[model samples]
Structures are given as C-alpha cells and as structure tokens.
Target: MEIAVCRAADVALLDECIGSPGAVSSHARRFARQGEGGGTYLVAWIDGRPVGHAEVIWDGCAAPEVRAALPGCPELNGLGVWPPELRSRGIGGALIRRAEELAREYGRTVLGLGVAADNPRAADLYARLGYRRLTDYVDRWSYEDRDGVIRECVDPCTFLTKELPSGSLDVKRT
Candidate 1:
C-alpha cells in the first residue's frame, strides 16, 4: 500500500471510510480540507484505491491537563484511521510515525495523542510504539438532532505521550 497526504478531493472517500459503524466518530471532512494550524494527514492506498487514512492536529501547546499529568511538549490530537478493514494493518501506526516526524520538524521534543478509553487496540498500539500513558479523562458532549433534541454521550479519553527518536516508532499488536 502507498501512503500520501490527503487532498480536498479525497473528502468523500475518507468520509465513507471513517463513518463506518465501528468507528468512534467520523469527522473526515475537517481533516480532508484542513484549517489553520494544520498538522498532518495521510491516506493509505491499496491497489490504487484509498483504503485507510489518519488525521492529526498540532497546536504547539500540550494541553494543560495533559502536561500536568506527564512531562511532554506539544499538544497532538485527532489521530485516527479509516475503514474497519484496516485496523490491524499497521496503517494507524504509520500515520502516527509520520506525525512524530512532523513534530520533530516543528522543533518539538515530545508528542501526545488522545484515545478513547474503550479502544484497547489503539491503546496497545500506542504503548508498543513507546507512548506512555500520561493521563485519562472523560469527554462528554451533547448532540442535537434535526428537531433540536439533545442527546448526551460520555467517553473516556486517554492521553498518551512519547518522546520521538530519529526513526519511526515501532508498534506491535498486544
């Protein structure tokens, strides 16, 4: 598979990939187009078709809460892979490795990410990549439907931080 930065044209495809039932959330359009403080985004193409993707953001500031929990620099957020089929194929790890590369380019010494607590697979993947658990918090929000009826949802967010080396961090299934 070939991996490359996602372009605006890939939004629809990425949306399709990330919006599948098993995913925690689907916000592909935001990453596909990018905004100020854009971090890094990549897509894995298999047989010339987009099959997997990862999106991330860097604000140059580690969240105060995350910093209080661990020693690290630079806030990283929104890293995810698309398509349930690509879960264990190393696509997510590669995307993170690329993000670390960008972090170093920005003169950062540490990188961090937030994963939902329910996602043990992602937590294990990050651990194997040398990311140590820094802190855990709950993300609670409300969503409104067409009628303005709001629904509440709560999810545990685990923040993991890692010091980057010169090479890609190796990740393994746990």
Candidate 2:
C-alpha cells in the first residue's frame, strides 16, 4: 500500500466508498484545508482502493489547550481505517509512519495526537508507536455538513506525543 496526500478525486472516492454525507462534506473540507497549507490529508490505498487515512495538522491541534501546551508540535489528527474487517492489517500503522515521515521532512522533532478517552485500543496503538501521554483535554470542533449545516463535537481525549527525531516502527504486531 502507498500513503500520500489525498487529492480531491481521492476524497470523492473516500466519501462515496466509506462515508456518509456529513463525512463527505468533512472530507471535502479537509481537502480544501490541505490546499490552504493548513495540514496534510493523507490517504492509504491498496489495489487502487482507499483503505486508511490520517491528517497532520501543520499549524497545531484543534484543541486550544493542546495547542498552548505543545507549541510547534504538529498534530496527527483524524486517523481511521475503512471497512472494519480490513483493520489490523497494518494499514493504520502505515498511515502513522507516513505522518511521522512528513513530520521529519518538515524539520519537526515531535508529533502529537489525541485519542478519545473511551478508546483504549487507539491509545494502545499510539503507545506502541512510541507516543506517551501529555495531558487530557476536551476535544472540540465544528464542521459543515453536506446540507451546509454546522455540527459540533466534544469528546474527552488524552493527548499523546512522540519524539520523531529517529525511531523505527518495529513494534511487534499483536
């Protein structure tokens, strides 16, 4: 599988293949954000199909607290793997490694991400990827759905960061 910055066409396919209308709108917005230099929206593909995704926020995180606390650290945001059955096949890990590689390319020494407090599984993934807890924060963000309606979200999250100077993703797969 190859991981690369998502394009508008890829976002359209991602939306149709794995998302709802709202998600389509969100993905489109992410695509726009990428164009504006806000972040790098990454998509992983297998056999010409999109399978996984992750975003690296070049400026910082959406959470205000995290931004203030970890200045200059790029965020690994909105990570996901499509088609639940396809999970645990290393797609997600590949997305993460790609994100880390981008961070290194940008001269960033640290990369951070937030795992929802309720999702220990994702937290474990981050831990195994060399991320350690930094703090807890309420993740808040809003987005415009397909119908042009704005939606809000608030989730409890544990912020984690990893030093990206030099590390190999050789942690044993469970």
Candidate 3:
C-alpha cells in the first residue's frame, strides 16, 4: 500500500469511499486549500485504489471558541475508511500512522480533534494511537440551506490530544 498526498481529483473518490455528500464537499474544500496552509490531506492506496483517507489541520490564529476552550493544537479533523467491507483489516491504522507522520512533518508538537463521544470504536482507535481525552464537551451549531430550513445539530464531541516525540517529523514547529 502507498500513502500519498491527495490531489483535487481524489475528492470524488474519497466521497465514494465515505458515502456522504456533506463529508465530500467539506473535504473537497479542505483539499483545495491544502496548499494555502489549511492543512494536509492524504490517502492510503492499495493496488492503485484508495482505501483510506486522513486530514490534519492547524487553525493558525483563527482558533474558534470550541477549539480555544481547550488548548490550541494540531487538529486531526477527519478520517474515514471505506465502510464495512475493509474495516478492521488494518487499513484504518495504516492511515492513522500516515496522519501522525504528516503531523510530525508539519512540526506540530501536539495534535487534537473532536470525536463523537458515542463512538467507542473511533475513540479506542485514537487511544491506541497515543491520543488522550482532554475534555468532554458537546458542540452545537445550526445551518440553513437554500430551501431556508434551519437545522440544528448537536455533536457530542470529546477533545483529544497527543504529543509528538521530539524530532519525530522533519519539519520545524512554527
């Protein structure tokens, strides 16, 4: 398997892998802005097919209130492996390892993210990868679409962070 930086073309493929239009659009924007310091996006490919994807973000100085309440750290924004079929085959772990490598390369000493508190599997995966829960918090936000219907969604998010070993990645911290 090969882990490589994602290009704009990979956005569609990634959306297919995750099976969500919202996730696809969000990630598409992230990939497009990777070159501008939004963060890095990568995909794990097996036999020329993408099997997993990861995203690492550094919010620079615009740290949102949600992120500021805890601590300012490299944020592992999104990670998704293709559904049921390839899960538990270690693809997810391999993708995470790549994310950690990139995080280190970006010169970030610590990484953090908000995960759904109800998802034990995801929480366990992060824990196994050295991430520790820093706070229990719920993020609430509302949005309106073209149809003018306002939808409110609350995510039970937990903030987790992991410190990188010194010199683990080649980049220098900013």
Candidate 4:
C-alpha cells in the first residue's frame, strides 16, 4: 500500500473510491488552494486503487470560540476510509500519519482534529493514535447535495490534539 499527497491524476480514482465525485472535487480544490490559504489532501492506495483520504488544513477554520481555544493548531479534517470492507486495515491510520508528517513540514508542533461526537469508533481510533480530547466543538457549514440542493450541517464534535516530535522544520509547499 502507498500513501501520498493527492495529485491531479488521482482525482477521478478518489471519486471512485469514495463514491462521490463532488467530494473528490472538493478535496482537489482544497489541495489547489494549498499555500494560497488551503491544505494538503492525501490519498491511500492499495494495488493502485484508492482506499482512503484525508486533508491537513493549516488554518483550523473552526468557530471563533474553538479557534481561540486552539491557537496555532492546524486541523486534520475530512478523513475517511471507504467501502466498509476496508475498515481496520490500517489505511486510515496511515493517512493520519501522513497528515501529521505534513503538519510537521509546515513547522507546526501541535496537530488538531475534530471527530463527530457520536462516532465512538473513530474517537477510539484517534485516541489510540495519540490524540487527546481538548474540548467540545460544533461545526456549522453548508454544502450542495447530490441533487444540487444546498444543505446545512451542524455537527456536534470533539476537538482532539496531538503534539508532534520536534525536528528540523521543513516548510515544503506541496
């Protein structure tokens, strides 16, 4: 299995893996905006097929309250491993480690992320990966559904954080 930053050519494969063309485009746009105020999108591949995805946002883009609480922390967002059968195969963990590596590259010491409050399994996974719950947060956002109708989402989430090991901070813009 190979885990790396998503490139232009991997977009369609990501869409197929996640079963959502819209999501693939959304992540691609985020990646395009990297260094211009966005983040890195990573894809995990097995046998040349995409199996998981995640993004590391330099800006937390959280609510003002949450932002104030987590000053200087970049967020690991939009993490997913697809096709039910692919769960527990370490793809998700590898994607997360890639995000941490990118965070370290940006000279960041603390990495933050929000997990859905109702998702205990994911929360457990994050905990095992060294992320400790910092605070409760709510994410309010809107997006277009498959039918092209805009829908609002208000997710009750828990903010978690982990400290990266100190190293030669290499600020690579990829």
lDDT of each: 0.64, 0.83, 0.71, 0.79
**Model 1 C-alpha lDDT per residue in residues 71-145, reported as the tens digit of each score:** 445555555555576678877777777667767766777887777878888889888999987778666655554
TM-score of each: 0.72, 0.89, 0.79, 0.88
Model 2 lDDT on a 0 to 1 scale: 0.83
Best by TM-score: 2
Ranking of candidates on TM-score, top first: 2, 4, 3, 1
True-structure Cα RMSD, model 3 = 4.4
| TM-score of candidate 3 relative to the true fold | 0.79
lDDT of 4 by residue, 51-102 (tens): 8888888877567756888886888888988877999988888888878887
- Model 2 TM-score (2 dp): 0.89
Please tell me which model should have the higher TM-score, number 1 or number 4: 4
TM-score: the better of candidates 3 and 4: 4
The CA lDDT at 119 in model 4 is 90
Each candidate structure's count of clashing pairs: 0, 0, 0, 0
Q: With candidate 1 superimposed using the best TM-score fit, by how many Å does residue 172's alpha carbon deviate from the native? A: 17
lDDT of 3: 0.71
- Encode model 3's per-residue lDDT on 46-90: one tens digit a residue: 777777777777762223554665555767666777766887777
